[model samples]
Target: MTSEPVTLHLTVGLPGSGKTTLARDLATRTGALRLTPDEWMQPLFGVSDVDGKRDVLEGRLIWTGFRALRGGLSVILDFGCWSPEERWAIRDLAGLAGADFRLHHLWVDEEVRRARCDARWLEVPHETFPMSAADQDRYLAACIPPSADELAYAPIPDPPAGHETWAAWAAWRWPSLPRLDLS
Candidate 1:
């Protein structure tokens, strides 16, 4: 019997870049499970990134996404995913889960991003954490846009040095994620 293909949709962007809006839309259209760390962080701990908690939460959410993929379900991870290494690792994880990977990169003018962040904070103070001007500037400077090859879904490159596999690297990167068994 032919089985349906599973997919992992990853959203990449700085805060206020409309990643969540796109993720929500994709989830509704595709019936994919949407996982957004911000939505959990606020209610769970009342703050974001306290003592590296966000990393822990993201690790668990990724594991959940992996399980859903293995069950032939699609997943959307609405993470800013600013770094290239993080994106690569997530793509590798999707491959391990036998799922196709798609990366969505959203971009907006700095002024517009700032304004959006301001509006979001004002409108839903409880739902979103406030983003300071310095935080926005730092995040924008640090964001690494996906290259053409990456967006094309090219074959994944080897894991970074010292890591035997992408799973190993992911375990190290997100300490909360257990080393996935390849068997």
Candidate 2:
């Protein structure tokens, strides 16, 4: 058995619940690859989130993360996986790869979360997101905290076979040169 050190770290909580901060810290300490959709959102589309593409982009990241784990590299995804289904899928993936999985749920008071969100810009100007009360409300309403056992996770529909698609590790193959037939 390979004694490779591989871990899958997932953040679970609301936006302002310090997921990113914790993710950053954990990644730094553990030398894990931190994947944050929010960090990519602003630069990619000039907005925090774009219609139709956010989920697709996140899915791609998850695929890449599994690839990393397969290589025995630790991965930290700071996507605030709020649903049991989401968390369960990740946990199952890690188990399949024989990697340690951890779910860090940032429990913060509502008032404190709001304050943190409000102070983000001033506190961390370089990495500020435009968060509104409406956004917070929407996220809270949609969030499904993991319950006891099951990692606060529930069964989610598994992706179809061959669902995890990725580029060949060799990167790409060049087309064979066509032979010139001089008759």
Candidate 3:
């Protein structure tokens, strides 16, 4: 087996799709580093004020992930990378590090996601709280969620054949790495 254990695993989904929770759980189970956009943004610009800070932090996180992969450490990136360009960037990063890259796209009903976001307002830190009604409406209008068709027909490498859950496939394919828990 190769001494290098690096692999880049990215979780893409809409807000409140359990990306952060899953990423954290995965990090704890595996020895992989977890990077969440919310965690990075909240400290610097606050969640409500992430418009300008997001661009900077996204670059920073991707760069940091690349560095970690070079050091033979796997990384889990929790971000809503709905854009095709963003996904491509991750694919390129994995190639640069010579590490296997896995993409776990979280799929949830729109109503379910919104309800979860509503409930999370009381659970998360004030700085990372959900947007106000007007703000949320505007944000939703401005940003479009990826459609099922988009995910099902992504250009990147498909998840291993016949494997439904990412955790199962990871454990089977990468026995050296601990199983990730998204639930």
Candidate 4:
């Protein structure tokens, strides 16, 4: 008998909100292929220095996600899908796959986010930085919160009983991956 296909769960959150960290933890647990926007963009075109290139990178990520879904791979997309339009785009892609798609919004307070940013700035490799402070400020400022109407589309609630935290779910899903102390 054919095994059941894996489900895709897209994790969305702003920078410094622990989206990537959570995604990594989830990936390790579930053995799902995690796709971070930065993973695809930085190496190909360098740091997003221009608006045009940033748009191009986003498009490429969307396309790559579509292809991966079609291939029946459970993907965890780690990106700041701050707007309803962007979330809708992801929803449409999930629909096309006929796979269950769940969104996990990494909710964190602004103070926590900024503190994480300051503390982890050096954690990002040199290849990803060197942009001016002005550029970083502009990017942060442009990150608008989701509207009430937009949030109505597909709100990400907490995981169900079998899958609670990343480690809990990961242990249940893929037993082969290395287990981390999430406690």
Candidate 5:
């Protein structure tokens, strides 16, 4: 019996770098599920303070995505995973689930990204977080793009000395999370 293998489409980019657009397109093209936390946050929870609650909100959505992937569906997580540690964590997740992984790391110039974000805010006020160039700059400043090897599932370097990584903390946060393979 041949079981279908699945892929995890990971988005890595600044807040306004077209991650969701690409994720939406990938989902439509591949018939995969697109799990975008920002979209969920607006509906489920009010947008009083979107940034303050994002980490918690995204954690839930990612858990759901993992469950979906386990059920044999391709998932596109449009979470704007900005840091290399964040990407590595999800890459490790794909590894655990035996899913093929792809990084859709969108790169746009700051000016262009800011313009796109302003337009998006106008187009979908409720659907998108209000973004400013300053916000985008902060996000881009913090981003650590994956090296070629990290994107390729090659052994990645350890986090810097004395730097307590978020991924390390996540293991504790979701201690019961299990790896799954349908095939």
Candidate 6:
């Protein structure tokens, strides 16, 4: 019997952009495992991204997601990857794990985004971190929206110079993820 192919879903956006909402919907619809670092960060550390802990946690989540993919289970990574390079790395890694990759890029008006963030903080104080308008502005400026080529799922470009393979680059990018021969 042939099992259905697994997929790796990526959510890309700034804070308050509804990444989590989209991820939850996708997970429910597809029975995909959803991995959201913020959900863990706030509950376990009582804060987010302090001293690079979030990065460490995300790395482990990515590794776990890959394992799920290998086991023929679809996974969703609810990470607001601000950099195109990070998105590319994850997409390529998903391919290596024999999973189809989908990138969900969410965008919203700055004012709406900020308002949503404010409301979320008031409603779920324990589940989220407070963000000032300034913080949203800064994060918005830093986020690099996916380009037309990316949205089209164009062939992935070669890894940045000196990186022999995407798996190698991924291992470097997320130290907790061990280099593997997923080919």
Kindly provide the TM-score of model 5 when superposed on the true structure, using C-alpha atoms.
0.81
Model 6 vs. true fold: TM: 0.94
Tens-digit lDDT track for model 3 on 1-183?
223357788887777788888888778777788887677677767664444556666666766777788788999888767665456546645766777777777767767877788888777675356656676566456555555554454554444567554434434433333333334
Q: Between 5 and 6, whose TM-score is larger?
A: 6
Model 5 lowest lDDT segment of ten: 174-183
The global Cα lDDT (0 to 1) of model 4 is 0.61
Candidates sorted on TM-score, descending: 1, 6, 5, 2, 3, 4
Residue range 1-183, candidate 6, lDDT tens digits: 224469999999988899999999988888899999999999998987788888888889999999999988999999999887889899988988899999999999888888999999999988799997778778978999999989999998888888888778878887787885466
- Model 6 residue 48 lDDT score: 73
lDDT of 1 by residue, 82-177 (tens): 887899999999988989898999989889988999999899877788888788778878989998888888888888999988889889988899
Please give the TM-score that candidate 3 achieves against the real structure: 0.71
Number of the top-ranking candidate, with lDDT as the measure: 1
Off by over 4 Å in 2: 1-4, 152-183
lDDT per residue as tens, model 2, 1-183: 223379899998987899998988988788888999888877778666667566767777776777788787899988887766567666766666677888888879988998888898678655657778898889889998777765644443453344331122101110121111112
How high is the lDDT of residue 63 in model 1? Answer: 97
lDDT for model 6: 0.88
Model 3 score (lDDT): 0.66
Better of 3 and 4 by TM-score: 3
lDDT against the true structure, each candidate:
0.89, 0.71, 0.66, 0.61, 0.72, 0.88
Error of 2 at 97 (Å): 2.4
For each candidate in turn, give its C-alpha RMSD to the true structure in angstroms.
2.4, 9.7, 11.1, 12.9, 4.4, 2.3
Q: What TM-score would you give candidate 2 relative to the actual structure?
A: 0.77
